[model samples]
Target: MNQPLTLEELKQVMAEADLLKTEADVEAALDKLAQEITARISESLPVVYGIMNGGLVMAGRLLTKLNFPLEQGYMHATRYRGETTGSTDLQWQAPPSVPMAGRTVLILDDIFDEGNTLAEVVKACHAQGAKEVLTAVLVNKVHDRKNTELKIDFIGMDVEDRYVFGCGMDYRGFWRNAAGIYAVKGL
Candidate 1:
């Protein structure tokens, strides 16, 4: 097994990271996403569900931009518990608390990488009788490996294939609070 990173080691990794998206860039993307979402679903009583841990930051930032009244909740579903890589199996730690039956549901997440997790979440909402399910992501990773047919409705930005951390994404379960998006050096 790989040893856990020390604080100083993690800091060094962050310091050497390649800046992919600056804070301003992320904010600008969010602003655009807010406008698009408002135009499409502002009047609808949408239930926004944040895919927890990773999605928290994106969801919080988006909620403030939205002008209309809507319900908010979070669900904890993860393929990477605290690792840089991912496993095929998904673990659902918690489900959304708010009811979704016959309602419009929006699922917000940090990144759309392989699209498996988002696809599963959308299916769950539909299984519970959601009238509609919409998807959004802070970053859409460019890759050829995809396992789902679901499409992200709102996208903040597109990033090249890299091991990214920050802006609600983590490095060894840390650095999710970093202001900008960063790709670790030599990853």
Candidate 2:
């Protein structure tokens, strides 16, 4: 069997294969995303929502980049856990601490895979009577849409369905802290 793609291998592919598009090179893109989020909701103190589990690392990283005062909150909306594919059934584990009613809310998520989690979170935000609801994501998989109405207002990268890990995305419920993103070797 072939060796799994390690961090070094990802770096090699990133350099040689031009695997990441220049327009959305990871670091530059992240900086742009931070700027975009800052511009959209430039309030004194904004209630930022993190869709837990996957979004944990990304939201944390992005929050540190903001210039304005920010309050942190998290809600767990999961369509997939450790499984290779997504499931239709979505479960919300926790709700935001800050009152979402009539508040500026910025939702940070890991990936726009099936769109289920994104769509559900949007609905949840509305249900909480958010003054305005916005979204940001690390990756957007351009597959057939399970929920097309939802869109990622800010994105770090658009990736193919090769099972990515790192940059807040995960495979087998691990590898979130990887410096660069990676893919599974066989499937």
lDDT of 1 by residue, 1-187 (tens): 6688998999899989999999999999999999999998888999999998899999998899999989998899867676757675667889888999999999999998889878878888898999999999999999998665888999999999999998899987799999899999987
- Which ten contiguous residues of candidate 2 have the minimum total lDDT? 15-24
Give RMSD to native, each candidate: 1.8, 4.6
Best by lDDT: 1
lDDT of each: 0.90, 0.74
Give the alpha carbon lDDT tens digit for every residue of 63-177 in model 2: 8888888888888876666454667666666767678887888898878877876887788789879888888887777678547788678887787777777777765455676
Candidate 2 residue runs with Cα over 4 Å from true position? 1-24, 79-90
Choose the strongest candidate by TM-score: 1
Residue 97, model 1: Cα distance from true site in angstroms: 0.9
